[model samples]
Target: MTTLPRSYWCHRDFDGPGRGRLELQSMTTPYPGRAVTWMRESVRDALTGLDRPTFGIAWAWLGNHQASGAAIRELRQGRPYTFTLPAPDGHWTWSAHPVSVLPVIETCANAPSSRQQLVPAHANGDPP
Candidate 1:
């Protein structure tokens, strides 16, 4: 079984001018598990940070007969309200909450890490 808190090499495939799919391939050698198909869009642009190999985090919970996972939120040109993920250092931090956590999906693109963003940085490399 795959474990949580693992890193992934993110990629994107454009279906058209304004549509594409996002994928998260586990960094494990020999590819021990299925690649997580994050999203598939037929009418929207590809997610950010997907044009190239992007580093990402993967956290999942497997139980009963279902599974769920999380990564950074999709990219947005406008500012969006976001929730905070408290860091252990006692410093308040913020993170973009997934648009739909029920099955983990977003309508926008996923930006690169904070270090690569133009706006102020978030604790976890999330674009603000």
Candidate 2:
């Protein structure tokens, strides 16, 4: 078996009682800091041989996130792998730059309250 990163990427999810219908905007990232979770489908389509990439994800850190103050919850199949992304001064909670790293994969960033709050990072924090 191939030995992966000792510290693989974890995951995070944001879900609340949808006021309208049963909808889920799932964005799973890594923990202990700002990381990314590469799903099975993504791996197959992108990394091919790296399909079963249990390496989890690759992300920045809580301090590296934007100033959105987004809410999230950590989850796992086995025991809960708990950790924290220390917040920087004034900066909001840990946000992610999805498309920044790879292709297709998009992440959430912070935007204005009145305007569209959800910001999608390009394949490298670029524009859509």
In model 2, the worst 10-residue window by lDDT is 85-94
Candidate 1 residues 79-113, lDDT tens each? 22222222222211112221211233564367455
The digit string of per-residue lDDT tens for model 2 on 1-128 reads 65332222333222333324423233434342333223222222322322232222212222333411222222222223323322221111122332212233343345335533355556447787
Question: Which residue pairs in model 1 clash with each other?
Answer: 18-44, 74-109, 75-109, 114-125
Report the backbone clash tally of model 2. Answer: 8
State the displacement of the C-alpha of residue 7, model 1, in Å, after optimal TM-score superposition. 17
- lDDT for 34 in candidate 1 is 23
After the best TM-score superposition of candidate 1, give how far the Cα of residue 92 lies from its true spot, in angstroms.
Answer: 34
Error of 1 at 51 (Å): 18
Question: What are the models' TM-scores?
Answer: 0.15, 0.18
Instruction: Specify the highest-TM-score model's number.
Output: 2
**lDDT values, one for every candidate:** 0.26, 0.30
